[model samples]
Target: MTVPAFSLRNAVRASAPLAGALLLVGCVTGSDIEGLHRHVGDVEKRVDALAKQSSSKEEVAKLNENLGKQVATLLRSNADLGAKFDELTRELQTLAGKLEDANRRLAQLSQQLAETQARLAAAAPPDAAALPTSEATPGTAPPVAPAPAVASAPPRGGAPSPADLYAQATADYQRGQFELAREGFEDYVERYGRTDLSDDAQYWAGESLLAQKKPREAIAAFEKLFKTWPESDKAPAAHLKKGVAHLDLGEKAQAIVQLQFVVHEYPSSDEAKSARQRLKALGSDSR
Candidate 1:
């Protein structure tokens, strides 16, 4: 019985030595464990650096995208502004052109007005006896009427009548001697203001004033003809001349009204033709 107990104890002791040998064989080397720890630390450092670099790159890319968007918006805004500036410049150029044209027309009108006033002050009145007389026929006899009982007197050459003087004045006017013609015409009108030639004299007198560049006096003469002889053949012409006088005075609205009346009332007359031409020049030929 004692031998059986020793055998169990010895079997347990032999198992303990076997277990210690296996432990020694399976244990890690010191150098290998240290190398593994160093490798793990390097990996941790590399991961941290990689994460920081990746975050920086993402931030830079986002900033670049935002900058690109801002630059694009600025370019678009600049283009829009440039387009508006171009439109405004064109509009200003058009307006300037219009103003220049208006100024030129105004200057022309002023020059015309000044010239028209200079001729009015130099006109003169006419002399009746200075008019030419027709020679007597060879067969015409001398006057034989009995003289009054006082002192005997011989008959003198008969002076030309107002009609003959007016004829001479018209001939002078046609020959371009407007100053002399204007005097004669005015004399005829004054001497024969109640005669049938009064209206004709008045009209020709105004025409002479116009030929002399006396638009104000011409206007007065024409207005007198129109008012005094509304039914005369010269009425339309008088109104036409009056319109021209208004134009000389820079009265465009009044000139247009009078010219329109001429065109409307005397459509078939030469005066109407002149009025239409004037209306076209004034840019008011809508009719």
Candidate 2:
């Protein structure tokens, strides 16, 4: 804009000098006046061209400003999308935990029922199979007395089933009885390690230990889960907990390693989001 305006001013100045020259030379001819008019027309055309070029430059700048705003808006939208994804990940983890507990309970009940039926069937058949088909004669070998029936049902008092044990341990954890919950969960995993809830039990045991301020023990518990149940659904959470345990013990380097593992290994998991947050807090790379 400034360059065009400067050219226009200089053109006006030059035209003034020409008009003065025309006035000074009273003998100027019609042809000379015509030539001067043509010169003025050319100057006018040049000014118009420069003005148009300046306008085009302004329009280009406006377009660039709009593009920058759009880019900033897109970046904000992407951040919002990432936050929503983290929320969904947390919700999915919660639902999966609930489903796992339900399955464990149902499976445990079915197994206990089948075992009871098998025991009763085995106890009753032995008596019949031992009896002789014909009546016993005096000289005949005396019929062997039937062995005592093995009890199928528990006595009036008995320990709870695996399902009940797990439920009680979860209840204790919910009630803030971390020590008791830790013991119960460890016991379940030790005795019923093949059960569906074993991995879940082990994970909760680590949680219990962490809650009790025993971060060292909690790290061990979480490590046990990783070694014994590497394919468990709770592996991501276990990694996250282990990282937190390290933090509690002021083991910054180890904590960062564990947190980064979760972020890289389970990027779509809720635990990964938590791990990233922790990594960011520690001034480490989350990726």
Candidate 3:
């Protein structure tokens, strides 16, 4: 592997032209070098895309399927929510219907209680015999006396109990003694004005006046009751009777005003029902 000094010198001299020619041929411009780099980069990008093409398509397909499943789940949830909403609506409607029916039944029971308390104040068998039983006897004649009220009068120089006085007053009214009934009820209203039955006594006084065919006096009595005891449960009945008294006197305008008042102020009362009937008969039903 060692060469003589003269042979090495000769070999270097002979390769000088070849080295110069090689340098001259490799002298490229900057633009030509950049173009070669761009070509290499483009080739590398094309190869990478071709190698991943099938995998990229498969990944996109999987993504689309996952999205479809999510959409279907959302649709099912919406359907379930809609069904629940419909069920709640139906349940509320049923509850409202039941509440309305219960209200109607309660109104009827209260009306019956307000109209009938004769059995509570009956003093003896004779008084009891004068009233109808729980069920009506269809063939019985129309009542010759009061429909269902009577009590023996209290007898003493001292003042009687409130109950006995009230019972006796009602008894007088029922027994066709209108003047005596009016006097007794007026006395009760004057003395027992703060008692629970005071308003009722005043109302009966008006009824007594009406029974005697004194429509003007009955209206005055009703007006007194209204001013004195506006909160009485008997207010509606009083209004109805006042309206009827007006009707009996051929005062159609006055009757309409009173009847319409009942329909408006006591819509749930039995008197309201009667008022509505009367209004219909007078060709002025308020509906």
Candidate 4:
């Protein structure tokens, strides 16, 4: 029979802050014990005995069986402590893996964003002042063309430009106004779908639904984002969030599939770290 899943909340609490440092200490301790077990060398055997004093109470108890009851009890107590340390070491290694994955993703995101910015800068319109000047005849000014008539006047209450719409949507999201944010983001996506920020607008529209606890709607929104912008920079994040939405709806199987896809396809992404954590919480083997 399968073992019951461990409580993620409890695990998080036990890990606290110093978990990573402890992993290194545990690795050293385990390695020393291993070398002695294998009879690697005299020096290693000496290190192993010392390390084992603090790392394995069972060994101490067996070796000092002829000692007094007090010594036996102390040795047993140390063994129990060692067991707990071993468990903590395993948990710390898992956390370290997740942290390393997250850092790699952040670096990739920074690089991708920098490249996007560079492309945008390179594509920016030339300054009007850089336009070539035409020489006028000595006695006359250059002929000027009449400005084109406005096709339509600006609305009495000026409609928000694309940038204004995006800012308003982001502010609404930050303020926890999920419904308003959803509407604003949807509007932005609909009106400016060809703009650079459209993918971001689409992604946040799903996030707003998620914030409102509408996981079904959020899933649909995320699906639409993927369908509409398959090549979007936000695609991996959208997949990750979609998996979370599935979890919120208690669709464990679908959640696993979506999260696994992120892990395999975007292994170096921050979203993949989150996906892996969720998979761990769900007792799914990401490997």
Candidate 5:
């Protein structure tokens, strides 16, 4: 039987060059057609691969954009944390300053208390009853004419009554008898609280309290003098003493207040000068 002839019209139109060669060679072989078909399939695969590569590039660019945003966010968060840390450090510094001020005031108060206690101890007098009597008398015997009636002890110097008492107290105070001096000064105040010397007595009383380590009591005494004799010469000194007592009591604000009053209210007074010096030592005075 005869084999049917393959159609060449459609096959030649698909590849003109190949069809021309085939016509020239008198016919196209199966191996040649298969090679051309395989070549066309490879070109299609290369085009598809290029398209996939372009898509991957676009995806990579999007990932990069997302990473940049994340980095920016992290930077902003770090800046905020840094600010918070600075604020906390400043607060700690402020608290430390306040504590230092408090401690300074406490130390001042303690010193004042000790001084007052020492003064009080030195002022006490010996008991009179403990001394031996120089003479004795029998009951109902007229005391043998009373030993010729001895004269009374004369007052020292020609000073005023209050001045005499003050002098005696001053002597005892100079001798380191703080308790005796304190009693004498108190007695003078009781007898002359309305007199010109009363202010002086009050001032000495406060000093005696301070020397006896009773700073709280000394402060009270000084305060009384200030309030009762605000226009007196002792006012400035009283305020100064009050400041010292307040310092001893660990009241820095209160002590500063009193010291400032002495410096400002009595700027020309000697006490004001002393207050200024003290304030400078404490690092509290600016002017």
Candidate 6:
């Protein structure tokens, strides 16, 4: 019985340490569960932050896309406006040019009318007594001497002088006897080339030829006037008529040269104005 009691005491001592180890293990398990809960909460918070960042990036992309579209639309609108402005500018330029041309034509007409009135005022009244004697039938004019002769002394009275011959030729020209007038004027120029009215007679001879559609003869007469009386008051008129005669002969380059000469040499004269008009018609831009 003493040996049995001693075995029981040893067993009790071992059981006491085993009970303490079990209690410590239970406390450690509870602390581990609390740490697991904290880790799960941190992971959830991180996922929420990532979701918000993704949504913000999507919103920013949409806003940027809308802004790009608006900028493209504005650029297209500006380009269209620029094209319309350019078209309007061209139309305005065309209209302005047409208006300028109309104004120039109006001015030319006024000048022509004024010149006609001045000429009528300067001309002398017609004499009925002189008209019947000077009026010759068409194609039935009296013959003038082929070569001019020295004027004979009047029959004890003052006969018509060289000046009277010029006046009679002018009358024939006014009556549209261009052939007879041309011959008479040529005779006057040949015989009285140094007289005061010689240049006038020569110029009228050219006019007579031009009226009869004789461009070559007209050109020759005008050239003679230019060479013989370069300082005459009719020089500019001769140049102008010579240019017209060249045009009649279908000599465009020669016409331009003669017209240009008139314009350059007599810029302030009526002949120059006519030359400018002719040049404009011929597509020359000479001022």
Q: Report the number of the highest-lDDT candidate.
A: 2
lDDT of 3 by residue, 122-232 (tens): 312122243235433221111122232555465576776567667778778778888998898898888778987888888888888888999899999999999999988
What are the runs in model 2 whose C-alpha is more than 4 Å off?
1-157
Residues 194-281, model 4: lDDT tens digits: 9877887888888888879999999999899889999998888889878877767766667778989999999997777767766766
Q: Looking at model 3, how many pairs of residues clash?
A: 0
lDDT of each: 0.70, 0.76, 0.73, 0.71, 0.68, 0.73
The sequence of per-residue lDDT tens digits that candidate 6 reaches over residues 33-64 is 55544654565565556556767988999999
Candidate 3 residue pairs in backbone clash: none
| Local lDDT at 167 for model 1 | 71
lDDT by residue (1-287, candidate 1, tens digit) is 22333354455445555555555687756565556556555655665666667679889999999999999999999999999999999999999999999999999999986775443323221222322234221111211222234643333465446656677787778788888878888887777788777887888788788778888898898888888888998788788878877766666666778989999999997777767766766656726
Give the better candidate number (1 or 4) by TM-score: 4
**TM values, all candidates:** 0.43, 0.46, 0.46, 0.46, 0.43, 0.45
Candidate 2, residues 177-243: lDDT per residue as tens digits? 9899889899889878997689888988888888899999988998898999889987888888888
Cα lDDT over the full model 3: 0.73
lDDT of 4 at 11: 39
Candidate 5 lDDT over residue span 107-208, tens digit each: 888888777555534432223342224322111011011122344454566534665677677777767677887787888788768976787777777877
- Quickly count the clashes in candidate 6: 0
- For model 3 the local lDDT of residue 34 reads 58
Alpha-carbon shift of residue 273 in model 1 (angstroms): 2.8
User: Can you tell me which runs of candidate 5 are displaced by over 4 Å?
Assistant: 1-161
RMSD of 4: 38.1
lDDT measured at residue 27 in model 6 versus the true structure, 0 to 100: 54
How many Å off is the CA of 251 in candidate 3? Answer: 1.1
